[model samples]
Target: MVISNKSNRRHFIKKAALAVGSALLLGGSLLPASVMAELGEPEKEELKFGFIKLTDMAPLAIAYEKGYFEDEGLYVTLEAQANWKVLLDGVIDGQLDGAHMLAGQPLAATIGFGTKAHIVTPLSMDLNGNGITVSNEIWEKMKAHVPMGEDGKPVHPIKADYLKPVVEEYKKEGKPFNMGMVFPVSTHNYELRYWLAAGGIHPGYYAPAKGDITGQIDADALLSVTPPPQMPATLEAGTIYGYCVGEPWNQQAVFKGIGVPVITDYEIWKDNPEKVFGMTKEFTETYPNTTVRVVKAMLRAAKWLDENDNANRMEAVKILSKSQYVGADADVIANSMTGTFEYEKGDKREVPDFNVFFRYFATYPYYSDAVWYLSQMRRWGQIAEPKSDDWYMETAKSVYRPDIYQKAAEALIEEGTLSADEFPDFATETGFRAPQSEFIDEVTFDGTKPNEYLEKFSIGLKGEEVIK
Candidate 1:
C-alpha cells in the first residue's frame, strides 16, 4: 500500500481492519493468543519517525517499506530531518513521535549536556556503519608515512599513527588541522578522537564547567560538526580536511574523487554500536503498548536486514538510494551496504560486518553500550565533572531501556515470528557484554568501571581532573 497517498492509506487501513476481523473469526490472528494477551492492542496507531539521511537509518526504512509497522497495527511515516539537532527537537516538541538518533543523543539530553529532556531508546538501529575519511591532498601526504603491504597497498586498519606526521607538518606551517564529525556526542566524534589520541595526537577537551564546550581546548586536531550529507561537498570545497561519518557519505567522497576513507569504525572498534531508536519517556509512558509494538516491528525489520548472510542488503540499498531515504547513488550506497568498503579509489576490501542491522544481537539496547557513550562524554568533559562508577551505571540504566526491548523480543518469539535462538538468553542476560578489548589502541573497556576506563585514556579527562 502506498502510504504516501492519503486515499490509499485510508483504504489500506480499512482492508487491514477487515483482515484482522476475518483472522479472529478463523482463529488465526496475526499474533498468537498468548502474545496478544501479553501485549494488548496499540494505544496509538499512527506515528511519525525522524531520521538523518544516513545509511544506518535502514531499519526504519525497511520497517515502513516491508510493512512490519503495519503488522503491529502502526501506520508509520518516516521523515528525514535537516540535522541531528532538528531531529531531536522534533521529538522533544511532539513534532515527531520518535527518531533515529545518535546513541549518545538520549544520554546527552537526559544528562542536560545541550538540551534537557528525558529521552529513551528501546532499540539500537545498527552497528559499525561509520568511517573516517580525509581529503585527497591529506591522504596523499599521509600515504608516504603509511606502511605498504607486499601487495603494494596500504596495510589494513590504517592507524592514525600514520596521520600524526601530517598533522605535525600542518602545525609546523602554523596551519590549523581541522576535521569534522556529525555531532559533539556522536560516535563519529569519539571514534575520530580515539584514532587521533591513539596516534599521540590530542583531539582536545571540553570544559563545560568553565563554559568552554568547543572541544578543542588543548588540541592537535580541531574537530567540528558537519552534517553527514554535506561531508563530501564540504571536503571537496576544502572547508574541512577530514570527517568521520556514516555511509554513503564516506563512499560519496571516493566516488566524487575528493577523499579517501582511511578507516571504518569497524576497524577502530569491531561491531561498535551506532544509532538508536529514540522516543521521549513521556510518550512511552503514555502509550506503553504502542512503544512495544514499535519495537516489535523494528525487530522484524532488523532481522530481515541481517538474515541469510545479508541476502536482502541489495534490496535495502535500493530503498535507501531513494531521494526520500538516504538519497545517494545506488552504486555508492551498495559500496558499503553490500559488505565491501572502498578506502581509496580502487582499494575496496571485504568488510562484511560494515553495516550490521540485526546479527550479533545488534538490536538489543545493552546498558554496556550506553555506558560506553557516557564514558566518552565524561572523557571529553561533556559531563563537566567527574562521575562515580555507580553514577554511570545509574545513568545507563535510566536511558537504555532493555526492559522495553525484552518485551518486544519476547512477543515476537511467542508469536513464532522469530526464534528463541536469535536473542540473548534473557534468563542470564545482564544487559552488559563481557569486558570489551577490541579497540584500535588495544585498551580494554570494562563498562562497569567507567572511571578506570577514563583513567586509561591519556588525552582525556579522568578522576577529579577538570579543565582548569
Candidate 2:
C-alpha cells in the first residue's frame, strides 16, 4: 500500500507539473489581468499559517501543495497548532497570519465571548464534515431504542432520544452522564447540544457571568472539551461516553471497533457550515490585496476538490494522509472523504454530501452562517445576557466578510478559471440564506430574524433571559 501510494503521489505531482510551473511563473505578477487590474501587490508575500489536523483544512493544504498560494504571489508556510485556543491565540498575537478555524471562533471572539479579539473570515472552509460517535457500551444500550431497517441495520439519523434512555439510566444509577465536544464555542458543542435537546435531554448551559463557565448548569448530560484527534482514545478509555467531532476521528472509532458513529452533523442540520479561514481583522485591513489574493487561491482549491463530482477526492485523501497533515491512515480518512460514512464496523453507507467543499456555495462566508453560530452561542448562555435581533445582525456583519469573498470570486471568474454562475449572483446576493427548516427538531432558522428564531426553541435561553 505504501509503495502504491508513493507511486500515485509521484504521478499526481508529475501531472500537476505544468500548473505548478505556471503558478511559479505567475508568482511575481500582481493582479490577474482581467478582474483586478488596478489592485496592487500583496503587501506581505511571506506568511506563516496555522491549522488543526482536520480533513476540512484541505483547502489550505491543497492551496499550498498545488501552488495556488504561489500563483497569487504568496509564499505560505502551514503549521499545525497544539489546539484551537493556541491556534486562535497565534492569529491574535501575530504568530500566525491566518488559520483554519471553527466557524464559531471568529463570531465568539468578535462578541467578546472567550478570548476577545476582532477576528473575521473571508471564506468558509467546508460544510458537514462532522459526526457523533458513542462508546461500544453506550451504543449497545441505545441500540435497542433505535429502529432497525429492513436489512436489520439500525436506522440512521438516529435521534438522540435513543441516547436519552441511556442517560436517564445513568442518572437513575446516580452517575454523571458525560460527553465531549471539541470546544466550548464549537459547532460540535452546539450541534451535540441541539441533538440532545431535541431528544428531550438538557445538555446544560454556560454562565460566564458567575464564573461558572463549565456549562453544566441545569444539566442531564455534562459536556467537556476534548481535542479532535484524541476523541477516539478518550472515549475508549471511558473518559467520555460519546463525542461530537469532525472527521476522521469518528471514522477512526469505527475502524478501531471502539465506538459507533450514531449520527453525522449532516443529519443534525443538512449541509451546515463547519470551519472557516480566519485572520485578525487588522491583518486584512492592513493587507487588503493579500487578503483578496488569499481568498482567490483558496477559491481555486475548493473548486478543484469538488469538481467533476468529487473525482479528485481519492487524490485528496492521499495528500491528507501525509505525516504533516491529518496523519491518519488513508483508509480511515477515506471512509468519509470518498463519500461514504461508516456507523458500525460493517455498516458503511453512501453519503455523497457528507463532506461538501465547493458545492452549495460552501466557500462563501455568508452572514447567515455567522448568525447561526451566534444564535447557538446565545442559546447556550455564552452571551451571558440577551441582546436584540439588531445586535445579532450587526455582529454577523462585523465578522463575515462577503465583500472580500466577492472580490476573490469575481477575480477567479474573470481569469476564466471559474464561471460567474458558479457563485451566488453578486449583483443580487444578500449574504443570507433563505429560511431553512431541516434541523433534527424541524425548527426553522431565518438569519434576519435571529431573536424570533431563538424564541421558537423549546430549550435554550430566549429573549430577556440570563443564567441566574
* Best-performing candidate as measured by lDDT: 1
Show model 2 residue runs off by greater than 4 Å: 1-36
Model 1 stretches with alpha carbons more than 4 Å out: 1-11, 14-27
**Weakest 10 consecutive residues, lDDT, candidate 1?**
1-10
Model 2 per-residue lDDT at 177: 93
lDDT of 1 by residue, 1-468 (tens): 112322246667887889889988998886778888989999998788999998998989998888788777787878889999999999999999999999999999999999999999999998999999999999999999999999999997899999999999999999999999999999999999999999999999998878888899989999999988899899999889999999999999999899999999998999999999999999999999999999999999999999999999999999989998988899999999999999999999999999999989999999999999999888888888888999999999999998999999999888889999999999999999999999999999998888998899778889998778
Best by TM-score: 1
Residue 26's lDDT within candidate 1 is 95
Deviation (Å) of 310 in candidate 1: 0.8
Give all TM-scores, in the order shown.
0.97, 0.94
